[model samples]
Target: MKKEIIIKHLGVVLLLNGVFLFISFLISFFLNESSTVALLFSALICGIFGVFPLIFVERTEHISFNEGLTIVVLGWIITCVVGMLPYLMWGGEFTLTNAWFESVSGFTTTGSTILTEIESLPKGILFWRSSTHWIGGIGVILFVLLILPRSKGQRITIYNTEISSLSKMNFRYNTRKIVHILAVVYISLTLLETIALMVFGMNFFDAINHSFATIATGGFSTKNLSIAEYNNLGIEVIIMVFMILSGNHFGLIYGTIMLKKENLFRSSLARTFVSVLLIGVLLVTLKLYLSGTYDLLTSLRYASFQVISLGTTTGFATVDTIHWPIFTQIILIYFTIQCAMSGSTSGGLKFDRVYIFFKLLGKQIKLLKHPNSVFVSKFDGKRIDEKLEEQTLVFIVLYVAVFFATTIILTAMDIDGMTAFSASIATLGNVGPGFENVSSLGNFASLPDFGKFVLSVNMLLGRLEIFNILALIMIKK
Candidate 1:
């Protein structure tokens, strides 16, 4: 299976992580923080391991599908392992399980955390944490693809493995161009958000970190109260704008910026996604206001933020939604399951699939009424073939089964039904905060170690998109 080629590519992933770790180390070193040595040591470990393989293995221009898949899967597992090193060594709230959970959550951009006192951590550690989101937001393998000076075949192989077919639906470019589009859109959004935050009186460090979290849709906050700590309407408005943008397809964003044909306004999927989010906001805001939860403006503020936050799978909280009305919570839960667009940073059961699911359902209903009629399902004006349609349906079923299985496993751990169910979907959707014990503004510190571990696996499954891991397993068998 071209094991050497796999190792070489995986080494690149580690090296990329090592670079971020070193940046974190420098932050700790300059600040004389407690995590300095830990960050430094972790960075060194990544560098040494990363370099050794590159030194020994000759670079190959071509990689098999199995090798590419192995590299992509193992690359994430390895990165997560190394990611926990700083937390494990720093040792404040980080036990072994806690470190692993935090690492998985970070790289998966799940935003779920084990820290009870997030503000107590060193700046370097916090930066490293946010860095994980940025690195993983676009994907570690995609970063490697950008740097790898390989042939088109090599790039395409890894690209196919790293990105899903659904994500590539709107991207009309070749492999290199597609990767470049993602990088450009990703970096531009991050920089723009950072500047906006700083202009609104956020300090540079916090601004950049929050930008990393926002553009990545990763939801990790520098403060304990998340965006609520700022309490600035301007800041909230800026983040909400970016959060919505980040949730849309990056290619569409690029196209819109470049005045291309496949822009967000031209894409039906993008329009529907936005419409659904607005509808969610309206429903939640109306309920909050009518229930006397808050005045109209106040209700609109919190409801819009939470709705968009969870809708995009960003998970940042402007309010503690646990105290909200049940109808509002259910609406939020629906958004958690129906996450953002496919090509964006946010993960989980993407809104595109949900859109397609409904379309397919309508097609089936029409067929029942007219037995001889042929019904064709299409998305964004493109025909959906039977094969892709079957695959999407299978994916949805698998997604449901996996989350339900996780819920069962968590319940077996003796967690409350609400916590277990919400946590299951939350982690599986990579949507961070859930209701009950793991609600918005609450940490995962109270969960059993095994439960945290299970959720960590859920985050990985969500990030890997179910099929990749299953394909890898089949390859092994």
Candidate 2:
């Protein structure tokens, strides 16, 4: 297992995180926020640890899949450790546990928060929150892999760890090209959203921060009420459009931008993803209207917004859903579990997996009907390997099991069944927000410290993907 090589690669990740911290510090200083010292100190600490390895270790030409797995899993843990330092040092709603929880939430792009009053946070700290989304949106290692100028042969394996299987379908390009395409699309969308927000009268800083959150499908908002605080239909529509786009595979967005044949419009998986979301919106809207949760138009508006928000793994809230009917909440929770596409920023049991699961179901039914018949599962007519199908199924079971276990633990701690269950699935899916105590507008501040800690671990496990962490533990001696 080339431990030194893994350390060296990890050092690169630390350095990347340090750069972002430095940026946050400057923003803090300019804004005269109390978070400056925290950001500066965190940056220094990251720099010291990151650079020390460079002095002791030599560069390697390659890493094994095992080593890559170790670097990625450990890299995330280390990144979260480092990512929390500023909040810890700043000392507001951020005690050690709170900092770790928030940092994990940020880097995981879960957008689940523990703070009760987000607007009370300093601008620099808020920017740091949005920055975590930007960094984690693509992935910490991905940022390193994308910006760094070299190959270690295990690039695709690392990328697969960082992204998801479903996201890679549209990319026939080589590793470098794929990274380039992802970067271009990510940056372009962020810039475009920022411009749109600015035109809607957000200041440059708030617009940039909000754009970062939106493009990442991260629900961290400059305002406590999130995009709702804007009160502009234009802003909401712009956010919604981008949210839907960000929820799809970045590779497809790249294809469309590059004028490649396999664009978003052509991908059957993407079509189904949106179609399912629309249906969910329609259902939730009808339920809300029938129940008098809102007028017809208002119900549709909030329903579509909330549906897409959770559907994409973004956690922004215009209205608290804790009081919404159980049926509406169930629909939103379904989207939360079924997150956005693999190639994009959203995470969870990706729509691709759900699609694959149904296809695999049909394959099984066919096999039962014709015992000797060959049944090859397909996604968009591409043959889905038996191994991949098996792995996906295992992942889903593990995901549910973990969620259930976490829920049980929380329930034992006296958290309600609904809150515990929703929180468990929310963290397990890397989708932010839960019901009751941790609902759309509610925060996790009141959770027992140990419960918050457990959920943070769940967030990391989800963000890393279950198998990657498992593979990290099972590396051959």
Candidate 3:
């Protein structure tokens, strides 16, 4: 590994974080909130650390996969750690564990919060909270890749760490162009979402925060009740639309925007993702109505929003799924696991793999019947290689195994089975909420420190996807 490159990239992270902290300080200064000292101090510390690395580490022209992997993984870990400084120092509902949980949740774009009162936070700190989503949504590595005047090869090395294989399908551009496209799509969506929310009766602060959340699929609403606080169908609809869009591959969004032939509209995986989500919504709506939970209109209202929210791994809630019928909860859980498309802000086992997984399964079945048949599983006429199939299958198994292990560990700590299972799946899926004790509108603050730490690791693993992590670990081995 190139230690200098790792330090240099880490330095860039510190600088980026410092910029946000300075913004927070300015907010506190203007508003005269108690956060001024803490935020400013944090900014100074980050800036000093950032500059120290710059002074010591010389510039490099390229980075190997090992350095890039280390930077991405360590960058996330450090980002969460540094992100907690303000929350840690400000000290309200933010206990050390709670602060870490909240920071990790934000940076992971998971949207889970320890605060019962979202409106209770200062504007500056709240903006910082939402900023974490924006920064983390595109990925810390991608952000560095975007800004650093780096070569395509150098960017590709880091891009490998930031985005999973499935997410890259539509990104035919070289690394530099891809970065430009990602930035444009990300910024445009955020700006548009903010404007839309503002038009629908949200204040500028809340609008910006929610937009940041939406475009990032990071769902940290300023109101504790989330989008329900507005009670505006128009607002919810706009948000749902963007949530789905943001959950999709940015490459597709760029392609569509640039009027390229290949885009979200062209991808089979995108179609399947939407179709599955639609079916999930329809099923949940029926269950809710039949169970007498809500009338048809009300059921569709909440069901559609909640399904899309979780399906995209956005996690904004109009209604808590925990109190819904068991059947409804199951449908919601499926969406959570399925997640959004690859190459977008949303995390977890992306829809691309899930779609391919079934196709691969069908090919296996046919191969079984035909004996000596040569079968090729294809996605949108693109032949899926045997190695790709094996990789996807391994990811699926590891994804389930990790969740199961987390559940077992949580249950051993005297938690209920349902809560443990849901919590495990929620964090592993990078979906914010779970059922029962960790339900929508609930927080992970109550978890034991060790449990919280374990869950945080799961969040990183899920966001980064399993193989990149394994690859990084195996590099040393």
Candidate 4:
């Protein structure tokens, strides 16, 4: 498995994480905050462990698929482990379990929080939290691939393991170009959002942190009320715009910006994703309005924002969704299951798979009626092969099974049915927030320790797209 090579690659990820931690330390130092020592110690630990591996291991020209998969999975685990250090050391509400949960949630871009009062955290710690999202958004391995020199074959191996097959369907470039495109698009969006938020009266610090969370679609807001605290339509609009864009495939975004033929407008999947989100918004808006939850304008605003936020798996909330009508809650839950496009930062059973599942269902119905006739499934004007179709179907079943199993476990722990089921879907989708107890404004602190750990696993499964972890388990077996 080239264990040394895997460790060496992980060292690079650790180095990158150390760089962010050092920056956070500087922030803490400047602010004279109590977290300064914690950040420094964490950074030092990362640097030491990170540099030691490089010293013992030499470079390899090629990495096998199994090796690459191991590195990606282990890299994320290591990143999350290191991520918890600062929180654990700082010593407030962060217990060992809480630190791990919050760290995993951040790196997975799940946006779920164990902290009851987010605003009480020090500025540096908060920045570190948001930084984890930005790093994890494109993936730690991807960022390392960009900066480090590696053979094309080696890069391709890791790239394939890290990114989903469905996501790669839109990319026509080599692995190197794909990495470049991701980096450029990610950085550009983050920078632009920071500026836009600053222009809209957000302070520079908050602007940058929120921009990191927004562009990453990670949903780790600096405020306790999330986007609701601002209550500024302009800021909300800007965030919503970025959230939508971030949920679409980054390759498509780059294509559109560069005026390429394969842009978002031309992509069928992209069109479907946007259309579904809009429909969700409309349905939820109507339900909210009819239920007398809010006036038309207010309902539209909040509904649009919440629907897009959860639909995109960004999870930024402008209102407490628990008080909303049951109809609206169901609509939101549907979006939580049918997440944004595959290539985007959003995770879960992607809309592409859901779209394919429906198309497959229709094909099955046609076959049932026509008995002797043949029917084929197609997407984006191309014929879908039976293998990919089968894979999609299996993925959906597995996704449902995992979430349902999680729900059962949580319920066995004495959690309410609604909280357990919604929490399962929310965590499994890597979409933060749930209904009833774990609603938009509520926190995960009330959940039992074992429940938090199970949800953390769910977050990892969602972010890694389930199969990767399954493949890892098979490899181990």
Candidate 5:
């Protein structure tokens, strides 16, 4: 492995983060907030470390697969480390573990937080938190790739490592084009959402922050009650629409906007994804209404927002779902486990895998009935190769095993069964808010430090995709 190449690429990642940190510092400086010095020092540290590599190591036109993987993995780890600096320096409820947990949650777009009083944070700190989502939403490495001029080989190598095979399914373009599509869609959505939120009475700062969280599907709300604080139906409706859009395949979204043949309406996967979300909404809404939790309209309103939020893995909550009926909770849990589509910002056992799993199951049953019959599974008119099928099944099993292992570990720490189980899946799925102690309205501050650490690892695993990390390990061995 070319260690220098890895360092050089990783430097770019740091510089990208440094740029955001500087912006955050400006926010603090302008507001004369307490975090100004901390943000400035953190940004300087990132700049010094980031620039040191470029000055010493000459740029390379290419990097090997292993080098690319190392850069991608290390980029995230290092980014998280640097991400925690401002928080640690600013001080407050941020202990060492709490800072690490919040940083990981933000970068992973997991949205799980350990802070008990979120509203007390400085505006600069809050913007930095949301900035982490926007940065990590498309991916840190991809941003680096965008600015790395003429390094096609390096770009493709790192792009492949950063993006999953499933995510690439809808992206017919080459690496550069795919990266551009992601940036365009990501930026455009953030801008449009910011405008919409502003139109609905949110201040400029709040609008941009929420837009960042919403577009990234990372639910770090400025208010303690999240979207509930607004109490504006228009804001909720706008967020819900963007959440669902953010959860779909970005390539398909780009296609739809470009009026291409493979637009959202034309893709079966996209159609089914929306359909499933609607069905979940219907089920949860009915349960909420029938159980007298709310009137029909009220139930639909709250239920639709909650279902879409968790269904998209955005984690922005309109209501405290912990008090809802067990049936409704179960439905939400299902969405938590079966997260958003593959190519979108949301993570975990992607809906594509779940969609394929059932399709493959049906195919197997059909083959069983007719012993010699040939059965091939397909999605969106594309054939699912046998190897890809095997890989997806293995990934699902491994994903399940990892979460189960986490749940066991959490439970062993004396955490309750519901909290442990829900926290495990929620983190592993990068869906944020769990039940019980970590309910939609509740934070993860109550968990022991070690328990928070374990969930943070889960967040990274989900964000990186289990296979990527495991493959990197295998390569190391």
Candidate 6:
């Protein structure tokens, strides 16, 4: 492994983070918030550390898979650590553990926060918080790769590490084009959402912040009540629309917008994803209405938003779902585990794997009836590779095992069963909020420090995908 290459690439990532931190510093300076010095010092620290590596390390044309894995994993750890500086320095509700938790949650786009009084923070700090989501939404390495003047081989190697294998299945483009498509789609959605929110009566700052959270599917709302603070139905509808779009494959969105041949309309998986979400909405809405929790119209509105929000892994809340029927909560939990599509901003056990898992099961059933018959599982008209199938199955099993273990740990830490289980799934799925204590409108301030650390690890595992971390460990060994 070329240690210098890894260091150099990580330096690039830090420099990119420095750029965002500098932007936040400017925001603080303009607003005259107390966080001005904090943001500036953080930016300088990033810049100094980032530049130091570049000063010594020479450019390389290629990186081995092991080196790429190291760079990606270590890069994320370094970025998360640096991201906490401003929060720590600002020092309101941010203790060392809380800062680390919030920072990891931000960069991983987990949306699980520890801030008890979110709105009490200054505008600059709040912008910095949302900026972490946007920066992390596409991934730190991806942003670095986009800007780095590197060999195609080097770019492709790192890109492979940054992007999920399942997400790459739909793309026909080369690595360069794939990178471009991701950036273009990400920026376009954020810009469009910002404009739409402003038109729907949100002020400029809040609109842009919400737009960042929405497009990234990060769910860091500017207000304490999340979308519920804005009682406008139009705003809710707009956010819901974008949340659903953001959950699907960004390449498909780009293709659809560009009138390409294989767009969302032509993709079977996209159709199924949307269809399942619609079914979830129907079930939840019906339960809410029948339970006399809300009128039909009100139930539809809240159910639709929460279902889509959590379904997409965005984690924004339009209502406190803790008070909802147990049936509706279970349905939402199903979506939380299923998560959004691959190639999207959202993370966790992607819906693609769930879809594949069911198809794989059906294939097995067919084979049982005729011993000599060969059954092939197909996705989007392509024969699924047996190797990929095995990996997906193992991934699902490992995902469940990890979260189950986490739930047990949290429960042993004296958290209630529901809260512990839901928290495990929420953080492991990179979906924010759980039932009971960590409800839709609730924060994660009450969990023990050890539990918070465990969940932070869960966030990284979900964001990086389980196999990458396992592969890294295996490679290191």
Off by over 4 Å in 5: 144-169
lDDT of 6 by residue, 329-430 (tens): 999999999999888888899898998899999998988898799999887778878877887889899999999999999999999999999999999988
The per-residue C-alpha lDDT of model 3 at residue 229 equals 79
- lDDT by residue (440-463, candidate 1, tens digit) is 999899999989998999999988
* Steric overlap count per candidate: 0, 0, 1, 0, 0, 0
Q: Estimate each model's TM-score.
A: 0.96, 0.95, 0.95, 0.96, 0.96, 0.96
Model 4 shows how many backbone clashes? 0
**Deviation of model 6 at 457, angstroms:** 0.1
lDDT (0 to 1) per candidate: 0.88, 0.84, 0.83, 0.87, 0.88, 0.88
Candidate 3's C-alpha runs over 4 A off are 144-167
lDDT of 4 at 264: 93
**Residue lDDT tens for model 2, 331-385:** 9988888988887787677777888899899999999999899988766667887
> Model 3 residue 446 lDDT?
72
Residue 258 of model 4, lDDT score: 94
lDDT at 184, model 1: 86
RMSD of each: 2.0, 2.2, 2.1, 2.1, 2.1, 2.1
Clashing pairs in 3: 167-343
Q: Alpha carbon lDDT of residue 115, candidate 4?
A: 92
Instruction: Score residue 268 of candidate 6 by CA lDDT.
Output: 82
Worst ten-residue run, lDDT, model 2? 147-156
lDDT of 4 by residue, 1-477 (tens): 778888898898899899999999999999999999999999999999999888988988776667777887888899999999999999899999999999999998889999988899999999999998988897743563553344443544335434445556667876688788888899999999999999999999999999898877788999999999999999999999999999998988999999988789988888888998899989998988988889999999999999999999999999999888888999999998888876777778878788788888999999899989999887777787788788888888899999999999999999999999999999999888998889998889999999999999999998877787888899899
The sequence of per-residue lDDT tens digits that candidate 5 reaches over residues 1-477 is: 878888887888889899999999999999999999999999999999999999999987765667767777888999999999999999999999999999999999999998888899999999999999988887743564553343433434334434445556667776688788888898999999999999999999999999999988899998999999889999999999999999998888999999988789988888998999999999999999999999999999998999899989999988898899999999999999999887788878888888878989999899889979888887766787787678789989999999999999999999999999999999999999999999998899999999999999999999888877887898799
Q: In model 1, which regions exceed 4 Å deviation?
A: 144-169
Model 1: residue 125 alpha-carbon error in angstroms? 0.3
Q: Which pairs of residues collide in candidate 5?
A: none
